[model samples]
Target: MNRPHYILQPVSPLFITLSLTGAFMLNLLPWGRWIGAPDFVALVLVFWGIHQPRKVGIGIAFFMGLMMDVHDSTLLGENALAYTMLSYLAIMIHRRVLWFPVMTQAVHVFPLLVFTQAIQVLVRFIVSGRFPGWLHFIESFVAIALWPAITWLLLAPQRRAVDRDHTRPI
Candidate 1:
């Protein structure tokens, strides 16, 4: 794939730090299986995958998952593999995905997270012969419901990005 001028674009130091920190916090949020929700890291990966694929892709996902593994103490490779695969798929579909409206994107986003989580489930099953119960779907559901809000929150800084770009007169 042809690369965009992203490196030349010069993203904000604040946004980079905040987005990664937010991903970590979201992953750390405590929740039960009461309602189905999508994986927050997966959601963030998709968000960045579509909006800032160059800045956050497989490398980010792999490393983030590794961090998560270190904290969660699950199989080291399990989350890493799931995150990398999900990031790859999000980028592969990024172009086509950007065309959809936020609500429509959420519709598909639900399944995307499901697919990612399914990979995790499959891995767990093969490795341990068991998977998290029905409760885990709550993560995907919550991810879809929050998609619009999350996108806006993250992308809200974008208008400022243009302002930031124009200030220095490149």
Candidate 2:
């Protein structure tokens, strides 16, 4: 059986870095006691990790997490540890996850996101001996809900522009 061909576009490292920076900035925004504000930085990290695993891997995630740690003024290594784990998981499942439609991908991603959040919370509890408000856990679901949109936005630049001239092979 024959398979359809697809045109793949190259992604820039600078673009990926900029995207991660934007997400970090979004996280720093004051959402004012919102329970499900969504962890923008983590979401972006996971996206890049899954789509561009070669370029965006555990080291990048760890650094991003450190920046988040400092930005949030929380424990030093908490976010770093969580992001490291998230990136590892993202890379491991990247191929399988990317093969699915966006909605289906989100369903696959929710558990991973939740796992990262659970790690973060576990670290926080270990450091401070207390759990955050129950609603804090809802943020992972919020991120899950926004996955399709986020994937579209981040992948938009990397999508190949189709050529109408059918004579040439892609």
Candidate 3:
């Protein structure tokens, strides 16, 4: 006799959209003069890109970057470029990342988050000749620290009773 295979329910598009929207709303909130506020939008994009690559690909990341650019009043393509590249990288490593438990995954994800933030900083420096300073990179650390919490929050709702294979027939 074969053991039962448990499967999670398919995630709805509504949930994904709401998660991204919530990230955007968080990004919109002013966090005062602190220079290390995490990039919430990028965090959400990375999360979805890693977990749901088929649903959130480079195009969506680029579009979200554009939205962020508009929101932050930055150069039009700056974030688009960074986000597209980040999504590409996330897709490349999604398989490996997914195999790890969430805590271990954060260790793997930390570098990717730093790389994306580095790209953003580089682009801004190139465009304006202004260095965003060391504090800017600190946000990546904050993002890394928040990874487990964010993953828990986003995945909590979807982590329902795992269903047995019903399609296997009566």
The reply for model 1, stretches above 4 Å from the true place, is 1-13, 32-38, 161-170
TM-score of 1: 0.81
- lDDT for each residue of candidate 3 in 37-146, tens digit (9 for 90 to 100): 99888888889889899999999999999998898899998889888988899899999998777788888888888888889889888888999788888888888889
What is the Cα-based lDDT of residue 143 in candidate 1?
A: 82
Number of the top TM-score candidate: 2
Candidate 3 ranges with C-alpha deviation above 4 Å: 1-6, 162-170
Query: Where does candidate 1 have its weakest 10-residue lDDT segment?
Result: 1-10
Error of 2 at 62 (Å): 0.5
- What tens digits encode model 2's per-residue C-alpha lDDT throughout 24-125? 889888982488889998899889888999999999999999998898888998899999999999999999998888888898888888999899889888
Give the TM-score ranking, best first.
Answer: 2, 3, 1
Report the lDDT tens digits of candidate 1 across residue range 62-141.
Answer: 99889878867788888888889888888888888777788888886677788888888898899899878877767887
> Cα miss at 58, model 1 (Å)?
0.5
Candidate 3 or 1, higher TM-score: 3
- C-alpha lDDT score of every prediction, in listed order: 0.77, 0.87, 0.85
User: TM-scores of the models, in the given order?
Assistant: 0.81, 0.90, 0.88
| Each model's backbone clash number | 11, 0, 0
Residue 52, candidate 1: alpha-carbon lDDT? 77
